[model samples]
Target chain A: MIEFKNVSKVYPNGVKALNNINLFIDKGEFLVIIGLSGAGKSTLLRLINQLIPVSTGQVIVDGVRMDTASGKILRNMRRKIGMIFQSFNIVKRMSVLSNVLSGRVGYHPTWRNVLGIYPEDDKQIAYKALQRVDILEKVHNRASDLSGGQQQRVAIARALAQQPLIMLADEPVASLDPITTVQVMDFLKEICASDGITTVANLHHVDLAWKYATRVVGVRAGEIVYDQRPSQTTKNQFIKDMEIVYGRPIHHDEFVIEEAVV
Target chain B: MSDRIIVPPPKRLGQTLGILTVILVIVASAIFARFNIIEVILGLQRGGRILARMFPLPGWFGPLMETLQMAVTGTFWGALLAFPIAILSARNIVDVPWIRVPLRFFLNILRTIPAMVFAAMFVAIFGIGNFSGVIALVIFSFGLVAKLLFESIEAIDEGQVEALRSLGADTLTVIRYAVLPQILPQYISYTLYAFEINVRSAAVLGYVGAGGIGQLFERALAWRRFHEVGELVIVSFVVVLFLDFFSAKVRRSLI
Candidate 1:
């Protein structure tokens, strides 16, 4: 479980990224955040992992205060919170197996990790993670040799190797094709659902957010404008409310509509 | 329709002033240095006579090999030492100004001391040997490789570093997994470049009695043995050319 208590973030250059954000995320919930670029969605997600320190308020994750956490305590806390990025962030020159194995670096001694000597158990975990993401066949291949979609899957595998209690995704599918987007989102949803992982993702697609999110939270200008579940609101009502979140009517391109294959 | 032609763009006052300033600086420098065209012509004629005397190239096998050995040994140790120094100096790797800034300043100071000067100093201390020559090349190569490597490290994809940190990877672990892979090719290329430069400098290091073909050159020139000096030049030139070509090919494949 995660809790943001009156959380607010202001950059050094006087940009207010988040304002008085109070949100609670429960375990096993696929929570999707939707907003335009620079809407504080990224700042909010990064606060949970302590990548970006909050300007004010407390972010408590599983009873530890992320804002004030330091040294080993912070690292130990971070190891349990897995994150994936829009660019996939996998080392291109390295093998997929190596990239996945890097996820387990926090569990081992620094010297062992530096020498690239992962335990047999860690190797098993890495292989299983790659298997889960259906990239086990390309384990030995250089990550740069893979397509964008495959690279993202490898990144997911890398995060999965952590066996995390929580998963954070920052625009995970912004660079993928429509079909690959659905495929990747499906894998993410299914894995998180089965594993009972707390998932917080920032999505660009309005329709995908509706389809996948157990709870959808809409943000606008550093404020949470809408939060609802499908069972609590009709699809038409959700679309209508999204207008305020986007500050305009949702455009057609905001949704991923898969084209018919020839 | 009027027949209008495109005209050449007029030069701005700043551009014109800059060109004039450059020309004025060159002229002033030439005058200050007392550059003489007649003296240069006379020097060229003397150079041709020296060239005529340097014929039937003497055996240069031993000293050439010694020069190459120094380059190889120096580059190996220097580049190895450069790895840590570069990592410490890189802005992305070591964020603290106290550590990064001072390390960079030290590297700058090291680079400012030419290899020849380093050789001369080492020769004075170590008493004129290949050991001194090797030490000079090592220090020179370390400075060059570290400077280039730190720059490369700073320019790496920061997102990978962020990803590593988010996964709770320690600083060293982050460097190993994220930073090292990205820059390994560039690192190797830089080492090869340093080695190529070291080979040339190693040949000259013997001039300061630091051991190599340069010592042979000095001895031959002092004894008025122009043919032996010519042989050394020819051999060193061929070896340097071959090394540059080979290293360039290897460097190209790496990146």
Candidate 2:
């Protein structure tokens, strides 16, 4: 579980990315954050791990205060949190297995990692992670050689290899095609759900959010504007309520309706 | 539209002034250096006669081999030392401006001093031999390779590093997993490039008594053995050409 108390973030050039805010994410919940670009959605997700420091608040993740933690404590806290990016940020030149094994770096000493000596159990973990994402065949292939969707799957496997308690996805499928987007989102949701891992994903597609998220939160101008459970609201009502989040009527293109079946 | 004719645009005053400055500098420098077409034409015939006498190459594999050895050794040691320094100098890797700025300045100073000058200084300290030349080449290769490598490091995709950090990878682990893999090919390519340059400079470091075939070259010239000088030039040319071709092939394969 993660909690943000009176959290605010201002960039060095004085852009207030997040205003005085509060948010809490419970364990094993697939929470989707919906917002326009630059609406502090990313800032909020990153704050949970203290990737970006909070200006004036406490970020407590599973009990430890992330903003004040340093050195071994910070690293120990971070090891339990995995993050993925829209760009599929696996090392392109490295093999898929190596990229996945990078997830275990936090568990070992620097010299052991440098020499690439992972334990036999760690190797099994990496392989199982790859298998979970259905990318086991490409384990020996270079990461760059994979297609966009496969690359994203490899990134997911990398995160899973960490055996993380929480996974943060920043626009995880923003670069994938429609069908691939659904496939990737399905894998992410299914794996995290089965593992009882908390997942916070930033999604541009409203319909996808409706389909996957247990709870959906909307952000605007560095503030949370809407929060809902799709189970409690009708699909039509959810679409209608999103107008307050977008500051305008929801466009048909924002729904991702055509890709729903896939 | 078909009947319309476009006129040439007039040049801006600044452009005209820049061109004029270039021409002025060229003419002034040529005059100061006493540029004489007739004298150059006359000198060419003398140069041709000397070239003709220098034909029928002499055997001197020992010094040529020594020259190559110096380049190989120097480049190896220089690139070895450059790795850590380059990591420290990269802006993305080391965010502290105080550390990075001074490291950059030190590398700049290293590069500013020519290999020949470094050879001269080392020769003064260590005495004349291939040791001094190797030291010179080491310093030179370090500057060139480190500068090129750090720039490449700074330009790599930051997202990969971010991913590593989010997984709780320490700085060294991040570098080994994320930073090094992305930059390895370019780093090796740069080191090979430095080796190529070192070969040429190593052959000439003997002018400052730094050692290698350059000392032999100086001896040949001093003794008026033009044919041996010609032989050295031809051999050095062949070796340099082979290395350039081989290293280029290797570098291409890396990418």
Candidate 3:
């Protein structure tokens, strides 16, 4: 379980990126945080791994307070939490398999990893992760050579190799086209379900969040405005609640009518 | 779109002040040294007489070949030692402050000392041979190559390093697979650049009794054999130019 108790973040420049956030995410939950740009969705996701530290309160993951964790304890905590970036962040020069294998670095000693002397079992784990994402065939190909969608899948494979208990995706599909977006989102949802990993994703598209998310958390100006399950959410009420997050009424042009119709 | 805009040109106060300070210092130094343009003109007449004595060339292939050998040996040793030092000095590769800071400071100190001084120091220790020249060139090249390479390393796309870090690859693996391939071309270019510089510096190492073409020039001049000195100068100049051109071509291709 991941719990946020009055967790807040004030940047060095004094921008309040997160404001008194109190939330709990259970295992195997597909939670999507949605808001307009600068609403602290990314900041909130980063705080769970302490990629950005919180200014106040505590973030507890599996009963360990992240704010107080340091050195080895911090690294151990990070090992169990996988992060996916919108840019994929795969080393372009490395082969797809090597990129995936890198997710296993925290598990080995520094010297072994430095020498690329990963054990056979680690290689097996990497291959299995690639297989899970159905990109095992491109394992030997350079990451830059892959298509955008394929590269995103490779990134997912890398995250899976970590055997993470929690996965945090910061706008994972923002850079992808609509078709690829669904494909990537479906993969994320599937992995979350199959692996029983609690998944937190920051999404821009309201329809995409509604389709893939079991629960939606809306943020506005660094504050959580609404938190609701999809089953309990109505289209009109969702749009109405989104105003507090977007600071304006949901524009008709912004909605993908085909998805809403479906 | 402007509504009665009052635009003032950017102030030139800094540039004007800098130029004025430079002029003032130069004027003050010239006055203190009793500057005389007439003295320089008279010295040129004496230079004409010295130039007249260097007409006939002496045939000495042995000394010429020895100089070439010295330059080649010095350049090779210098470039060889620079490789690891350059890699260690790169900020992205060596994150430890204890290692990086000291290595950077040492490289700076090496660069601050002139190649001539290094040659003189080595000649004092090793005693009048190509060995001293080669050691000087090696140290000199290490300073030059390491500075260029570490700067190149610092400028590399850090995204690649971060990606490697995420994979859990050790620092060395990241450097070998990600960092090394990208910087290899530039590294070779820097080595060639260092070699070019070393060849020029090595020729003069013999002035301090470290063997090279400069030794032949020194011997001929001491004995008042202007013809032999002229021959050594011409040959060394041609060799330096040839090496410079060849290294430039190679660097152009590598980069």
Best by lDDT: 1
Segments of candidate 1 deviating more than 4 angstroms? A258-262, B1-59
Instruction: List, residue by residue over B1-255, the lDDT tens digit for candidate 2.
Output: 223222222346669989999999998998999998688888998888888688733446677788899999999999999998999999898688888999999999999999999999998999989899999999999999999999999999999998998988889998999899999999899999999999999989988898788988899999999998888889889989999999999999997
Candidate 3 per-residue lDDT, tens place, B21-65, comes to 999999899889999768887898888778757763344566566
TM-scores of the models, in the given order? 0.87, 0.87, 0.75
Give the Cα lDDT of each candidate.
0.90, 0.90, 0.80
Looking at model 2 chain B, which ten-residue stretch has the lowest summed lDDT? Answer: B1-10
RMSD from true fold, candidate 1: 18.3
Model 2 lDDT vs. the true structure? Answer: 0.90
DockQ of each: 0.28, 0.29, 0.12
Residue lDDT tens for model 2, A21-51:
8888899999999999999999999898887
* DockQ-based ranking: 2, 1, 3
- Cα lDDT of candidate 3 equals 0.80
- Using TM-score as the yardstick, the better of models 1 and 3 is 1
